[model samples]
Target: IPILMGLFAAGGTIYGMAEESLPFYTLLVPVMMAARFDPVVAAATVLLGAGIGTLGSTINPFATVIAANAAGIPFTDGILLRLAILAIGWLICVAYVMRYARKVRADQSQSIVYDQYESNKKHFLGDHDETQTLAFTTTRKVILGIFAAAFAVMIYGVSSLGWWMAEISAVFLGAAIIIGLIARMSEEEITTSFIDGARDLLGVALIIGIARGIVVIMDKGMITDTILNSAEGMVTGLSSFVFINVMYWLEVLLSFLVPSSSGLAVLTMPIMAPLADFANVGRELVVTAYQSASGVVNLVTPTSGVVMGGLAIARVPYVKWIKWVAPLLGILTIMIMVMLSVGVML
Candidate 1:
């Protein structure tokens, strides 16, 4: 499931697929709970899987393409390097999630959220009988097929057909109606079911909305511009090694304030990219460093709707998530810095 999440994220260039991942928390949380894992495991799998993939985005139009364009280079300039980082970073994330998952599965006491285990189980699993084996009815089989087809079409639409969030939402909404019809649900039942599902996600929706509001406030105050100017001044005359690393860390800090990858790309690349020449580094390395830092920071940045919203859906507390993911973040930061330094030398 984590691998599938990563693969989907690798193709999520249109809007970064942050909110797109929300629905999966409802789907995967119960399944992971049934398998004796906690909600944290499900949340980590989706968050880290997608987060790491976005961090190493090779062809993602939002991060790589936008940054490269702003840096006055072809998007493909450092494709091979990004692809390598994607692969290595994804492996590291998968192994980290699996280790925690295995520990939770083998002994529930090892789960980070063990105290909330019973409540989480009741909240996510509801009254479903764990001992009862559900037969694969034909209706269920068809519903599953439709569910899979909806995602397939979503990916195809986004990657090839220029579909944005509205189009993607339409596809899912249409699928939900069709599935409801196929199941012979009454009109009231379908509407009620939809409302119930939305209610369950109300907290997540508010978190996303509030996070966006914070971004709006920052933009209105021109704080983002001020920070960008400050970052530019800080890295003006450093050597290649120090310059790239400082740029990476600056981006890491900036991503918290401006979580939108494309927005950050447009804001910083032009200013920072030219500075790379003064430091005797290629502009492509600047794009690389920028995207890498953005990717790493977005993994846990609270200002990001994706991070806050995903945790809300998974019933994972923000602080607990930080505790669980801090080590993996440290490891990724080191790997990214090493890669950025090497790119400078090359």
Candidate 2:
């Protein structure tokens, strides 16, 4: 459990790595069930791991670069601060998951899905003999090397080579083919697997579309700016400390209404940036507050495709997720508040 959580936490550190959370949730759910855990643990693991990385994203282009650009600040400014956020957030997530995992492992009745354990085991474990020892063949080792090498290349590409989603996608496609071939999968088998995987995730795609459509409605209604303008007016004459906290919570509230980090950046930065000057807060702090608040909110917001879609895949209801995640979310919120307050002082 520690090793698994640590691996997922590391995955969160890289900028675009957390995008795999939805798919990883699907894969991890069965594995958790097979290991005598509730599927909710798998679902929570996905969001907490990826979401914390995003909340503390120091260098992720999607979360940090666009936000910095929108605020007209140097992208590298406050990087240390962001890294601090990442470190603290990652530790909190690991601790939370570890504590819950220990409880569930000690007593299966403690699991939310205890009633479904028998049926879940039947479905996920199948007829495979648990006692059989499988050999790690030379071919399998080579395949593992290929898999690791692909991600190493991807990390280098993104960190140093200015690669974005398109380049990363191409690399993944190439890696998929190489891995499949090395695993002795036939062409038809590869195609079938891809289709099946996509089919299972089709709802996630649709949910994302629907979430974006909500943004479209707000955009067409022409009320996004009004909300921003009203927010600015309401916060006028606040001191720097109060202003930063208000801005952080305002971003949290807006996250429910906007949800998309980049979209919120484009919408709020122009107003928030200049407002930061009047409020005597650094524009960098404003961007920090925006990204931190939005990223944290994504873990629980119903409007977030990642949140709802992942919950759906895990078969965990939205209310149940909120109940499970609320305590952790509260801890994270307090952490973000401290980070922002400190950012304002610095």
Candidate 3:
């Protein structure tokens, strides 16, 4: 599931796949709970899987491409470096989540959310029948095939055909109808099921709206620009090594205020990219620092609709998520600092 999240996200340019990932929480939370893992595991799988991929974005237009362009470099200028970071970061994230998952599966008492285990199980698995074994009938198999194909087509369309949410939503809607037809469901059943599913995710939708509202408020107040201007002053006249690391941390702070990757890139890269020359580092390194910091912060930023919405859908508490992800966040932070320091010297 983490790998799938990475693949799906790595292909697209939609705010690090934060909104794109909300539906999967509804799908994966129940499965993870049934498999004796906590909702945190499911939430982390999607968030970090996609987060790390975006952090080390190579071809991601919003992150890597836009930052590179604003920095006056080709998007492919540091492609190999970004790919290496993505590969390493993905492995680290998968291992961290797997370790927690295995511990939770081995003993439910070990789950970080063990206190809410019963309630979470009930909330996520209430519709499921534990006693009834599902038959792998041909109809079921075909439905699964269509489900997989929907995602495959979505990925292809986004990567190659420039498809966005409208196009991708149409693909899923069409696939859902086909699946309903294959299952021989009546029109009323289809509509009811669709409405129920949407109702179930309504809270997540609202959280996303509220989060975006906050971004809009910040923009209207010019708070993001103020923060960016302040950051510009702090990085001037530092040594190359110190300069790159400080730039990364500054970007991290800005990512919270401006969670949109493309927005941040356009705002900061133009101002910060040329400063890299004074620091004696490549502008591409500035692009890398900016994107990597944004990627890392988005993993946990409350300002991000993706992070909050995914947790809401997974039924994971925000505080509990912070407790669970802090260690991994620290590790990634150190790794990124080291990578940026190395890039400075290189």
Best by TM-score, which number? 1
Candidate 3 lDDT by residue in tens digits, 195-215? 998897898889888988988
lDDT of 1 by residue, 146-218 (tens): 9989988977887678887899989999999999999999999999999998898898889989988999999
RMSD of each: 1.6, 3.1, 2.1
Candidate 2 regions with alpha-carbon error over 4 angstroms: 1-18, 142-195
What's the CA error at residue 164 for candidate 1, in Å?
Answer: 2.6
Weakest 10 consecutive residues of candidate 2 by summed lDDT? 12-21
TM-score of 1: 0.95
Residues forming the 10-long window of minimal summed lDDT in candidate 3:
8-17
Each prediction's TM-score versus the true structure: 0.95, 0.84, 0.93
Candidate 1 or 2, higher TM-score? 1
Full ranking by TM-score: 1, 3, 2
Order candidates by lDDT, high to low.
Answer: 1, 3, 2
* C-alpha lDDT of residue 82 in model 2: 81
lDDT of each: 0.85, 0.79, 0.84
